[model samples]
Target: MIKVPIIKLRQNMIKKLTTFALILLVVSVTALPALGEDDENNFIALDHGYTVDYYKSYGAPAIQASITGDPEFERGETADLKIKIANVGVISGFKRLNANQKRINDSIEETIALKEMGEEEEATTAKDIEATLQSETKYIEVESTGNFQNVEELETGHTAPLSYTIKVDGNIPAGNYELLLPVTYQYQANVRTVTADAINLGITDVDYSREYKTKTEVLKIPLSIKSEPKFEVTNVSGSLIQGESKVVNITYKNTRETMAKDAFARIIVMSPLSTEKSTVRLGDIGPGEEKTASFEIKAAQDATVKKYGINSEIKYLDDDKNTKFSESMKVNLPLEATEEKFSVTGIAILLIIVIALYQIVNVHRKRNHNNENVSGDENEY
Candidate 1:
């Protein structure tokens, strides 16, 4: 070989040293336990298993995965991925070591029942019971690995599982892809010491396990949606003067599984008679629930004699947009069935005054004409 250049050898040595130093720094940071001071009660870490048994709930251990391709996605095309997670966890365990270095293990069992508790509160208490079962892993800790969007704290047995879908860019290539995910966990631990039955002055120490790291699996699942809405008019009857105010009642039912927001009820009168038309907004109605809107309608004094057709529409917003559910009813307001009374004496008094004033004006007019004729005759003579 040709003689080696000292300058080239020196440059290569420097490059190797710089790369080695960077790798060493990375290893030191990752191998170190999770951030936050570790004490008798707290233990934090990354890339390792947590002391908390994550399998207590069917929905816990949230794992999400996604894949994207180059050149963007096309319309009506899809790239799918499968998502999976380890659903198994150690529910509870206990162990003892004798003086002879003999080891013993047992499962702790306890029952707690609070009678007459509300359903939601009962479920929450069940989770707390599960946490208590993991008494050995009672130390608290925190760590970050960048996979999750934010820091998540998981108490023993108190976490619920989560799942989500990632739509692949339609134009992506049909191949396998991978991404580096960073995740963090903050947790606390509580350990049991001596029991009341223990006679010796010896003490026992409990330890919570370290945090864990695993890959996330993502899958493609399409969305499904449906809706139904119903309308009714209850307590539709009203009592008021022919020209006064009356109350109309309408009930709107969101028969659909989705919430109906910004809902409104429009009551239109089919009868032409001086109609009381009212439109009322009932706001939001939860799924499977009914809400009522009441409005006052004033009839005209000369309202029609026949029964009137009262129609209403319950308008609401669905995923597709605005929709209307309709209902109609015929209300009997028989004007002839009820009579209005006025004072006959008041009418007679008003007629008598009019006749007296007419007679006085006629007599005055005759006297004026006779005086005018006499004046003319005297002038001719």
Candidate 2:
């Protein structure tokens, strides 16, 4: 080994120092969490063998609404609306109790606010206490009710009921609609605090707070418009010829959830032999209703009188839109004459000919007998 000069040794020592400084800086940056401030377990309490801690807290009571009515409402009628409200707070009480305490007997009161959870935010035990002490208000809006309903001063484990009526206009079209109700609650909570000391004195912290808000639950309701035009046809039978005209009667019954608007019947005939389609339009039908449509069809010149298929499809409007329901059947067109007619006629003619022949033979035998008697009489003379 060769010994190094004093200058070279000094340069090597400088390089080693630089590398050591860089490694230390990298460790300090990467190990920041290890130097983080200590967590305060002020809210963590313990009992004989139980632990109680307020880890997460909410500032809003659960709101519920119940509606009751005819369960089946139609247009031009008033529907009753009843709603029940309640505050859900049993969880809040359980979280606030100490593990040492077996149960809580005192009433629990809290102020709630809706706040946004910011990015990289940590909840501290002190923030939970501040939230319970603040005042919060929530506003609720229901589209079905067309108004704002308020639940003022709702107590824990309590329910309130409200009722109202809504009238459906006679002219309203029938269909289903979804009622949307959105609720929003607003409040504030303490987020942080820092204290400053007087000159030459200890420091005191000033608490910092943040406003919080939350959206309420959405209420869904299915609302329907009602109408009263019903018509139905059943047991329809007849050949749907292409060009030749034929009449068929279809029995109908109105079995619709809602009434049919502008009730009418339209019959459409389709087939290869049918030249023009047939539709007999009849006017309005009522609910729980029954009606019949008589349709005439003509078979095309090329139409062969074979077993033609028949089907009836009914169309009506519910909630201002046309809806259709259909049924199908088979009918025999008068393609060929049945054998019954020819057989009956032939049998009758054959019977008539046999009777005439028997009469003629009997008359001829009588004449021969007369001749024999005359000849015998002449011989006696």
Candidate 3:
């Protein structure tokens, strides 16, 4: 055999090692996940005298929320909103730690560990869910105490609705609003195996304990506030006098984005105040438009001299021509005291009494003159 150079032989050996190393690096990068990324855990349950982290799951609970029914609501309404919470979580992959398998030697023990860890699908399950709904704008309010409600569990491919009461401001504009629903839930992160008997941990028929991970996700719920005609008593003119009928002019303003057709303004009057015609017709009112309605109201003679509150409302035809009534509005009207001055009738009576007194005084003066003349004539005779 021919002798080969030592450096050349070492060079061939080095090339083979470099090629082998390249192949190994490629396989490792493509095969298993990188360490400390999604691999194994260091948590060992010494209380149960067992090594945990039998399997590492590669998925978490993916939750999404949406409004159940009509997402659009009217203004000035306290409505119950049902939000449907669903879990769309799915397990991407799972890896069973081989070190635990070696530690558990018996076939029955390994089977038990496999069965316990096989429930990797539970990683997608959301449990002990606590949901809270919040509104960023002042126009909307989440009225439910403690931020609505909570859910026990939401399994994959299933949904559950949580009801919350929300109040919409009457003055809120007609538009879409973004409501935030923050949800906190616990999900199975990993299934840790208990090599010792499960009875020691107050659990029976189970050889594994669940490791839960808490996650917080803020979900957006889109809701729309419907546009509708809203009426308000903007201005009220004309004062009411005791024991007399007065014409009151009330100005109504449409403060919303919709129009009202064939609107009728009505006022409800209680005791000490009355009106023969309570309702007056207004032809049509548009957005930001104002309409004045006249009403004849009478106050009792014994009515107090103070400001009175008159409750009024507007009944109008909607876009569908359906009759609808607006929210009750209030306007303060002052009941003035009767003027402290004489009227035409009082002056006439005074004139008549003065004329009769003047006539009597003239008659008395004539009689006195005639008596003096008669006495003088007798003295002369």
Compared with the true structure, what per-residue lDDT tens digits does model 1 show for residues 1-381?
799999999999999999987876675555443434442223333222212221121122332323222322222233232222222222233232221101222323111011111111111111111100001111211122221332233332343332222343322333333323333232222222223222121112323223223322233322211234444444454543556666756566655456776788777654334445467888887867787877676666667555555566777776567674533433444332235665899889988999999999999999999999999999999
State the local distance difference test value for candidate 1.
0.42
How close to the true structure is residue 51 of candidate 1, measured as C-alpha lDDT?
21
lDDT by residue for model 3 over 1-381, one digit each (tens)?
999999999999999999987876765444333333323332222343544565677888899999998999988899988889889998888776754545456786667656766777788989889998999999999986756578888888999988888999988999999999999998877677655543333332344555678999999999998778998888899999998999999999998889999999999999899999999999799999999999999999999999999899999998889899999998899999987889899999999999999999999999999999999999999
lDDT of 3 at 315: 97
Order of the predicted models by TM-score, top scorer first: 3, 2, 1
- Regions of candidate 1 where Cα sits further than 4 Å from its true position: 1-225, 270-272, 275-277, 304-306, 323-339, 343-381
Per-residue lDDT tens digits for candidate 2, residues 1-381, read 998899999999999999987876674444232222432212111121222222234434455544455444565566555655555543231123221222433332111111112200322111111100010111112224534555434544566655545565544555655444444443232232211211112111211222243444565544555444433344565655344566766667765545555544555446543424355554455566666666666666566657665555556555657564333333334432222335777989998999999999999999999999999999997
Which ten contiguous residues of candidate 2 have the minimum total lDDT? 128-137
Report the alpha-carbon TM-score of model 3 versus the true structure.
Answer: 0.70
Estimate every model's Cα lDDT from 0 to 1: 0.42, 0.45, 0.83
lDDT of 2: 0.45
What is the Cα root-mean-square deviation between model 1 and the actual structure? 21.3
Best by TM-score: 3
